[model samples]
Target: MKNLLYLVLFLLAFSACNRKASDASYSWASDLHQRLLTDFCLTEAQVKDYIRRYLPDVTDEQMRQWEESGALECMMLDGEKRYFRNAGPNLFRIDSLCREVKLAKEGEQVSTSDRANAENLPEILAATDGRGDSCLAAPKRMRVTYTLTVDTNAVPAGEVVRCWLPYPRTDIPRQQDVKLIATSEPSYTLTSEGTTHSTLYMEKRAVSGEPTVFSETFEYTSYGEWHDIRPSDVLPYDTTTELYRRYTSERDRHIVFSPRLRQLADNLTEGEDNPYLKACRIFRWVNDHFPWASAREYSTIDNIPEYVLDNRHGDCGQVTLLFVTLCRIAGIPAHFQSGFMMQPRAWNLHDWAEVYFEGIGWVPVDQSFGLAPYAEKAGKPYFYLGGIDSWRMVVNQDYGMPLVPEKKYPRSETVDFQRGEVEWTGGNLYFTEWGYHMDIEYLNY
Candidate 1:
C-alpha cells in the first residue's frame, strides 16, 4: 500500500512535468514575442540565391556590403542566423544598385490594366474638381468571394472550427450598398454595426481527411474620393472636440511619439503652420523616404511606425502607420485605414491613412501610392495626400480593434483584418494551419 502511494505521487509529479512542458511548447508557438522571430526563416544561402535572380553577376563582397548596410535585414534566432522572409525582395527596393538592375531587367512595360488604373487617378481628381460636396465619384460595383480553409486534420475530426472573415464596413460614406449574397454556413453571426474590426462569424465541423472551409459572398459599391483644398481656406481644428482629441493623441505601441519620431516631425514641419500643409509635409517625407517592400506579419510587430523608421522601408500598412504617427505628432488628426485596393485585375491588400481636416472632415491619404508620377507631372503633386482611388473595400476603421463575439485566442492578424481569422475549440489556427483566398468580380456600375 505504501509502494502504491509512492507510485501515485510519482505519476502525479510526472504528469505535472509533462503538462508544464506542453504549455511551454505551446507558449513558444503562440506567444507574440516568440512568434515575431518565426517570419525571419530564410537562411544566408537562400537570400543570396534570391538576390542573384535580380543581379546574376552579384558577388559575395557585394552581398556582405549590403548586409552590413542593413539593406539585407537579418536576425539571430535561437542561435541560428536567419534573414527576413522579404529581405531578398526588399533588397531590390532599398539598394540603389539592386533597384537599377531590377528596373533594367523589367524595362518599361506596364500592363494595360495597370496603365488604366494609373490614368484613372487624374480622371478621378479632374471629375471631383470644384465639387467640394461631391467627394465621392466613379463608383464601381464589386462582388467578392472570400474563403478561408483550414488544413485537413488541423483540428480533431468532428470538432467545430470557428472562423471570422472580413466583411466590409457599411458605416463609411464611400462604401455603400453592402449586401451579403450568401455564406458557406446557413447560419452565421454578422457583428453588430460599428464593430471596429467588422467580421462575419461562421463555423464548420472538421472531417477526418477533408479541409474545413468557411466562405462568404458579398457585394458593395466603392467610390473614389478626391478633396481639393486651398491652404488658405483650411480651418483650424477644434482641439476641444472629440475627433481632434481622439485622432491626434498617441495610441499604444504603434503610434507613440518617441523622441526620435518627435525630432523627425519637428524637422519635417520646421516652418509649416497649417495642419493640412503639415500633414502634406509628413506624407511627402514618408513617401520619399520609405519605399514599399513586403512586410512581416503585423501581429508580430510591436510598434509598426518605429519598425519603419528603423528599417527605412515598409509595406503599405507599415508606411501608412509611420505617416499617421508623424501626422499625429505634428498635431494633424490622422488614423489608419486599410482593405483590398480592388483595382480590377490589380486588386490586393492595401493600407492608407485618413487625415481629419477641420473644414473638410476626414479625407483619405494614401502614402503608399504616394504622388502618382503622372499626377506630379500634371502639377497635382499631392494627389494621394487628400485624394484616393475608388477601388477600395474598407474593412477596419482602426487597427487592432476587437472582433465581434470576441476571439478566444490571439488573432492570426492582430493589427489588420483583411485576410480573415480562424480558430477552433482547441486553440487559434495560425496562418500555417489555414489559408485564405479572395476572388473579386468587378460589375458594371
Candidate 2:
C-alpha cells in the first residue's frame, strides 16, 4: 500500500512539472516538447540538451521557452516510438539547432549563411546518392483494362486510332475525347479505376510493335476550344523587346526581311495582306529552309537566324519554337502547341505553333510536315492554317502548363512524349520514332 502511494506521488510530481512546461507563457516550446515526449518518450532535459547541442546559437532562455510551449511539431515515427520535429514557418529555433549540429535545412532564412548552405546541399546529396550506382527502381506493375467502343462497326483499321492520340501513357486529360471517337458500347476498359483516369505507364519490353487496330467511328460533340482573342490576338513587336532584339541582332540584312518572301507576299495579296497569311508565309520559309535534324536539343537553340543562314537542319519542336520566337519579334501573336502525332510506326510526341491574326483569328501552322508538296498535291495556292491532319489528336491546346495535377512525374516541359510521367531510353532513342499500342472502348461510338 505504501509503495503504491509513493508511485502515485512520483507520477503526480512529473505531471506537475510537465504542466508547468506546457503553460501558456511557453506554449510555443511546451506543446511541441510534450508532443515529443509522448511520441518518443523523451525527457525534458534530453529534448532541451538535444536542441541545445544542435542549435547552440539559440539562447538557453529561448530554448527553454520553446521547449515549454513554442511552435514546433513533434511527430512520432518508427511505429510511434521515435519522435521527429520539422522546421515550420517560425524556424529560428530549428535553424539554431541545425547550425550547432552543422546540418543543412530548408526554408527561407533571415540569415543568408543558412540559405547559402541549403542551396548546395541537394547537389552534394545527389552526388553521394549517384555514387551508389543503383539503377532507377521500377514501380510495381499492375494490370489495367480499357474498353473501346466505336460508333460504327465498319470503320477502317487504319482510321480507328487517330494520328495524335497518346497510347502508352494515357493519363493525360481529355485524351479520351480526342483519341476515342464516338463508340456504340456502354462501358470501356481503363487501367485507372477512378472518376478521372490516372496517368498510365507502358514498358518498352511489353510492346512488340504488333498493331492493335480497331475499326469504327462514333458521333460526339468536339471538345476543342478556340484560342482567345484581344490580348491573345496580338504579338509582341517592341523594338526594345527581348525577342525582337534577339532576332535583329543575329539575322543578316538579306534574310531578316527577304525580298523573295516579300515578293511572295505580293503575289498572294487577296488574303495574303492579312497578318495570318504573313505568318504562314514565314512558317513556310522556316519549314522549307531547315532540314529536319534531331541533333539539336529542344530546350536551347544557339542561333535563331543560323538555320536560315546555313540552310541547315532542325527538328519539328525547334522550328516551332523558332517560328513562335520570330513571329513574336515581328509583332504577330504566336504561341506553342503540342500533342501526339497519329502515325502507324509509333512516333514520339509532336509540337507545332499558332499565330493569331486579325481577320482569320488563330490558325494552326505545322511546317515540319513539308507544306510545299502538300499544297501542290492539294492543288491549293497556299497550305491550310487552322486545318489539321485527321491523323493527329490534340491532348492539350496551350503550352507552359499551369493546371497539371499534383505529384506529376517528369514535370512537363514545352513538349512531352506520353501524356503522363515516363522515362525510357534504350539509351539512344530520339524523340521522333517510338511506338506503342492501346485498347479501350467507349460509349455511343
Candidate 3:
C-alpha cells in the first residue's frame, strides 16, 4: 500500500508541472494585460478610449489575430498609461483586435474631410521627350520637358513651387520606387549620402491626358554633406555599464520600464536626473545611431539594444521605440506618439517619441526628421529633438494593441497606414497609387 501511494503521488506532481509549462507559454499575454490594468486601473469601458488615444482605430479582435499570426511578439504598457510594441508583434496584435471586437473602433475613418480641390490642378499643355526612335537606337542621354500653367487664385498661401520628374510606370502599385526624377525648378536637395531628398512631396491628379513618362541615363551632381556611419558608431549598447540587472534578471524574458530602463540612471553622475538633458542625449543617440530605412515593417522589436546591434537600420517608429526603450532602461519615463506631418497642400504620416521630465511631464522627439546632421547638411531648415516641426499632426496616442476585456477578433500582425483621410462627409481622394508632376509656370496675371 505504501509503494502504491508513492507512485500515485509522483504521477500527480508530474501532471501539475506539465500544466504550469503550458500556462507559461501563453502567460506573456496575461502578464502584459494584468500589469497594464493594475497600474492604470484601466476598466473594460476605457479599453476603447485607450485604443483610440494611443493606437488609433485598432480593435481588440484585430490585436489578438495579429498576435496569433506571430506578427507582434510582445507588448508593454508604460507608467504614463501608454502602450508599446515591437514592429512585427504590434502589427499582428492590432489586426487580431480588429477582428475580435465587432464594434472595436480600429481607427477613426477620415473619409469625410475636405475633398482635394479638382480646380487646383497644374495645367499640362504638352510634354515632349527627345530620345532615339527605337529602344536600341535611343540616345544614351534623354531630356524631357513639360509646359504647365498655375491657377492664380488657387495657390496655397504658403505654397512654394516644387518639381516632380517622371518615373517609369509599373504594374506593382505598392512599389515606392516611382518618383519624379526631374522638375521645373531645382526643388530637391541631394545629400552626400547619395539619397536625393525633397522637402516637397507632390501629389498629382490627372486633369486631362495620362501623365507623361521619362527614363534615366547619367548621374546628376550636387555638392552636399554625406555620412557613412557604421553599426558600431551608432549602436552603443555594449558601451554602457549603468544598467544590467533588468537585462540579466531571471524572472521572465519579458520586462516593463523598470530595472531595464532605470539602469540608465547609473550612467548619469549625481544631477543627471535632469529629464531635459537625458532626453537630449537620448534623441542625439537615436538620430545619430539609427540610419533611416523602412527596413522593419510593422512587427515589434522593442529591445532597442538588441535591435540596434542586429539591424543597423530602422524607420521612424522603431527609432522612436528605441529611444523610449533606452530612456526607460536608464530610469527616465517615456511614451510613444504619432500623427501626420501636415504641409500646405498635403499630409504625410509621421511618428515620434516622448519622455517625461520630472517637471515637464511629456516632451516630443523625432529622430527621423533627418536628425541634426542631416538637417545641417541640407541647409534648408530645422533640427529635430526638443523642437518639433509645425508640419507634425498627432492622430494616434497608443503604441501596441488596444485594451480589450475579451478577445473579440484576431489582431493584425502588421501595421497599416490608411492612404486617405476623410471626415463624416466622405473626403476620400486616396489614389491606389500616388504620383507627382511639376512644371515651371509663370504666375497668372
Worst-scoring 10-residue span by lDDT in model 1: 22-31
- lDDT for each candidate structure: 0.84, 0.39, 0.37
lDDT per residue as tens, model 3, 207-271:
33333222121111111111111122222233234333332222211124445345543443235
How far does residue 117 in candidate 1 sit from its true spot (Å)? 2.4
**Residue 11 error for model 3, in Å?**
47
Sequence-dependent TM-score of model 2: 0.37
lDDT of 1 by residue, 1-445 (tens): 9999999999999967975665455663446655656689889889989888877777889877887876888878789888988899899988877888889998765654456557667668777772468777888899999999899999989888988998998899999999999999998999777778788999889999999999999999988888887787689888998888999899987899999999999999999899888887887788788887888898877799888887778889999999999899888999999888887677788888899887778889888888767667656778788887778899888898878878877788888888888887666888888888889988973
Number of the predicted model whose lDDT against the real structure is largest: 1
Off by more than 4 A, model 2: 1-273, 295-311, 343-348, 400-403, 406-419, 423-445
The C-alpha stretches of model 1 lying farther than 4 A from their native spots are: 1-38, 109-114, 377-379
Off by over 4 Å in 3: 1-271, 300-305, 344-347, 373-383, 403-407, 413-445
Q: Rate residue 169 of model 2 by lDDT.
A: 28
lDDT of 3: 0.37
- What is residue 342's positional error in candidate 2, in angstroms? 1.5
What value does the lDDT take at residue 187 in candidate 2? 32
| Best-to-worst TM-score order | 1, 2, 3
Best by TM-score: 1
lDDT of 2 by residue, 269-315 (tens): 33443455456667677766565543222212234344433324446
Candidate 2 weakest lDDT stretch, 10 residues: 135-144
